[model samples]
Target: MCGGEQGCIETVKAALQGGVACIQLRAPGWKKRRLLELANALLALTRPAKVPFLLDDEVDVALACGADGVHVGQRDLPVQTVRDLMGPGALIGLSASNSAQIQQADVAAADYLGVGPVFATQTKTDAAPVLSPEGLATLKALTEKPIVAIGGINHANIGVVAATGVSAAAVVSAICGQPNPLASTQQLAAAWQAGVK
Candidate 1:
């Protein structure tokens, strides 16, 4: 969800109202003060909803805001280091886009694996090569940790991604810039439920 702070907050509020299972703050370019402010605002919403709030690649802000945990990519801090800093109870997520990455991942330290670009994506310009649904499932077979499929996931394809047995689908454009994030989330949630069935 990349946008001005207020826009991002509103989108998050709508998604939360629409029952998103978790919230991850991913503001890579924002200054620390601004990021902290957004994290705190989001926490105010997520804590009450009982939804886990995770900061993406921003361990400092996450720790300062007392987020539920942090999600790190391959190049970010190592899983064990994050676990050590955030403590054992913190929920750590690691991104794994392919077999080698998955094979090399510190699975025991990460609470879950964010696997994808399930299709091509524009959200993260530097995202790894696309991992089609087949690739995602192949990786899934290698780990028992929960899988959250990310990158280019939207309403049209979420059902297919969900059908692959991923624990959850992480979307950016599908909800963030939609005319009605709440409705978009509701529809996608329904699609995911149907696919999982």
Candidate 2:
């Protein structure tokens, strides 16, 4: 979720409508029950649209809500453990902020990799150092899974991120902090698509 912490649900709804292929609900500090309840609501919003819904850091909530997947940080939950818990066909996205983390990933068990804080970001203040294009390219060369770049991404700089040839870009404040979230999301999507050629 966006760091704004306010109107995040509406922002998520707007982004889904604006053509984001997936949405990951990331509330790191919330209670498990509260997260589950939110997941239930988000699942309803995503399922009918045929878009995948992902939970950040909690495999239990992902399974409990019957969500499409979950994104886990290196320390949050071991990827193998989450994969085992979720079983087959469950999307398990891993956060790989550096070449080392990417190298350490169990690629066979992961659906995709999140390669970022492309630039520094406020969303997760504790994010690793910004990954330069060369570093990202190095990691990309080592794996086949489509990479999703996140952190400090917005319409203005999305072109640079998309040029890395990864599958998608994960956004937070760009769409969530706007007065018209749908329009903002659409703008970013259009930008991303245009950059992808």
Candidate topping lDDT: 1
Query: C-alpha displacement of 104 in model 2, angstroms?
Result: 1.4
What is the C-alpha lDDT profile of model 1 across 17-105, one tens digit per residue? 99899999887777999999989998999999999999999899999999999999998999989999999999999999888878784
Model 2: CA > 4 A from native: 1-6
lDDT of 1 at 47: 92
Clash pairs (backbone) in predicted model 2: none
lDDT of 2 by residue, 43-116 (tens): 88889888899899988888888988888888788878888898887888998887677777465588899998
Query: How much does candidate 2 score in TM-score?
Result: 0.93
Candidate 2 lDDT at 8 equals 63
Model 2 residue 185 lDDT?
86
Per-residue error (Å), model 1, residue 87: 0.8
Worst 10 residues of 1 by lDDT: 99-108
Lowest summed-lDDT stretch of 10 residues in model 2? 1-10
lDDT value for candidate 2?
Answer: 0.82
Q: List TM-scores for all candidates, in order.
A: 0.96, 0.93
Clashing residue pairs for model 1: none
lDDT of 2 at 187: 92
